[model samples]
Target: MKSKQENITIISIVIVRRFICFFGIAIIFVLNGYAQINELSIELEIVSISKGNYHPSPQELIKGDTFPKRIDFEFIVYNNSNKMLMIGSNTRCYYHSDGKETNYEEIGRFLMINGTDTIPLYTDRYYLHPNPHSSVKAIWGIIDSSKDFKACPIFTPFLKRWTNVGKDNTKELYNYLKSSRFVYVPILADYQRVLDKLNNKSIIDCIIYPRNTLEVKKKEPFSVFVGYLEEKDYDYIYPSEYK
Candidate 1:
């Protein structure tokens, strides 16, 4: 893992909440025994990263900019409804564990930064145009990945957008993806554990923040292989935060 950086800042949006109510949710579901999920999905994908304090771009860089150490990822939403799902104007991310709610001061935060120019990048925070309010506010937190949990994610995990199989939009959003039916929100790291000591090794956990959307009540065993980050050898596994 990389060393800890004293210079940290509170991000604008915090996305993590563990709410278990009563609903069964899964990344993949079948309708009438056919394999497919809902119209939209909030999925997670792994990315290999180097340890350092860096900014994704000159625009993203601020006073105390540092690459998130724990979790860094972007949430992509695919709309197969053949229609545009209106993006919302608000978002909230407050966490709770075992019935204990945290105060506003306990709200976690992370800097949203892209991994690479892997694809065209877009963020709801900066999406501006005819309707600035049209953007997906990625609200999430460390909720149990159990379907039995009353509150779980309803969206499924879609494959990489650039891939041909699930390739819904490789060239859909030419200029601003944030304004399109598909949205990408990058959740940088775990601010709650920001001050924790580094593992002092080149290998550290690389978690892609979330893999679903909407609060649900379901219990299904998920999260086993934890992905790891090391020198570009690309072999992987890190602590599975989803379960």
Candidate 2:
């Protein structure tokens, strides 16, 4: 015959052990699911590019010339299919020149905008390659050494040959940009939120303004995860601009 106090203590211990075991099992199941997700794969392509901001005339920065602080450009993306798609968070852009590929560090993230008529994803902006149309644009904001510019150059030759690179290059320029595809894995938390929005119908577009050129081609296919929209409705005004 056990006393009341002793019985209470024994019961408490049993409950505690059961809780610990249950928690451990839950953790294991979660890990196993995540591992399976990592094994999945997807394909992405740049469907369209619109005319953003074009300079009246290309500006040149001489040894003693002063350059503008920032430039703006507008580009649109087309998801290309009815299938609801997620931008591979791991994709990165790779820039190659001077017998090497440079690095393009990510400076911004993605945005989701539910417009009055359309749903569009506006990507995070980067400090590299702000204005791709600038002939004299410096690859990196800093021009300490010419080697730094190896990857940042606008690929003037490529652009000259393919006028539609900014419009319909996905089909015509796929071969040249084949290496353009790289790991586009989304950030962890973001990837989960995006994955939850399955079976959406809309165009997934990311607007990117890079500050560095050579670095763009040297990395994998990376774009800000501007969320998906209703394909039919896609317009959002920044809070500052909203009236």
Candidate 3:
């Protein structure tokens, strides 16, 4: 048997590796396959955005060693399903954007089509996410997964970060998002396990993005649901301004 110290060391190493997995492109290996039926359809939107080096420590709201030059964002995700969902305390969304742009190149990871341009996003909001991959707080059973279920909307706020954005051009990034009509996809997870009512086997993953399309249409004033994309928008073509 291993000594007490060795056991502790092994446990600590496992924890470190888990956090490191979320740090970069390593997240790609996680399989969030598309599951149809009573799974869940999420409606996501960006509430507010600000640029600075926001440190969570006392008196360091705008500058820190970890996020020295980053863009911070707030998102509201609604379950939008009739059935109750055990939302992972860490439910979050990552913006799927044009990777060729200098602004996005600096952060996140590549999602494979529209996701091809998606970068990983970290929000400073929602402190409930301790084990972002496997920790479910059992929160939001009242979650409005669908208006059909609950007429009113129920949501959770998740503030995330994208560090190393060119601070000077933060406004430019904002403008491009508006012009290009950026898209977002939810990264769902839970601590214990959420059953896939349709699949019979409990699964931690589900897929939503239309793999072939870019430019998920802006839903409502904030953005949610599937929308159309003109063919002109794809295949190296872009708005005249972007060209």
Candidate 4:
């Protein structure tokens, strides 16, 4: 269980992490047959994000330490692909140091869609150490996964609840994890990082550098879906002054 102070830290970390786009590097593993690539597009919107404190379920804790709490992020996603993209919640977590990400782990999951079948994604209430260093300062990215259901391809980060809270939209930190109120994001670029790697692998990974702070401004209420295909992949690559 986390103490009240720790809860605040957890929420702060989540909000900070949201600013960083999680990169999906190809997993270094054996090849499994590649799934047919269908036109896939993702849309996301985070309405409200806030932090709070709570206790862990295990009930075992250090004498002076409380369970870590987490921030709750209320967000939405859409899948505008030609074929159905399977998305699950349990996503990946990465930490950064000196402008590079080093710590990576797959924590929990969620399901989402391109307006086909909508789902909500939440985070576990308890705060897991964002990093090992005491002065840990870095952004995080939530990468989606495809391992929830067997043979489903599992598009990581499909919006779904990861809380044990009974049908309640508003829940405390501890109950959120117990009831599965968390969610995840899919990593289209990092297909090779899994235990079974995909066959047809070409690095489609991208880094978006918005020209000015005002360039990629969000028009609130709705979501924003950006598309990027590497220069070599397309015959005629559109030139962007920002890049």
Candidates' RMSD to native: 25.8, 19.6, 19.5, 25.0
lDDT of 2 by residue, 55-159 (tens): 334664222221111211222222333233223211123222343334333232222112221111222323232122322211111111111235554323333
Q: Which candidate number would show the highest TM-score if scored against the true structure?
A: 3
Question: Between the candidate structures 2 and 4, which one is better when assessed by TM-score?
Answer: 2
The global C-alpha lDDT for each of the candidates, from Candidate 1 onward, is: 0.27, 0.30, 0.30, 0.28
Worst 10 residues of 1 by lDDT: 154-163
Q: How close is candidate 1 to the true structure, as a TM-score?
A: 0.22
Off by over 4 Å in 1: 1-37, 47-50, 53-70, 88-243
Give lDDT tens digits, candidate 3, residues 47-84. 22322343545764443222212222333333333333
Ranking by TM-score: 3, 2, 1, 4
Which regions of candidate 3 are displaced past 4 Å? 1-44, 52-68, 89-116, 123-171, 179-243
lDDT of 1 at 90: 14
Scored against the true structure, residue 5 in model 3 reaches a CA lDDT of 100
Candidate 2: 10-residue stretch with minimal lDDT = 138-147
Q: Is candidate 2 or candidate 4 better by lDDT?
A: 2
lDDT of 1 by residue, 73-153 (tens): 333333344332322211222211345434222212222222332221211222211222322334222212121123533
**TM-score per model over all chains:** 0.22, 0.24, 0.29, 0.22
Estimate candidate 2's RMSD in Å.
19.6
lDDT per residue (tens digit) for residues 3-122 in model 4 = 999999999898777655232123311111122111222222332212122233566543323211222233332323332223222232221113244534233334332334433333
- Cα displacement (angstroms), candidate 4, residue 110, comes to 14
Question: Which has the better lDDT: candidate 1, or candidate 4?
Answer: 4
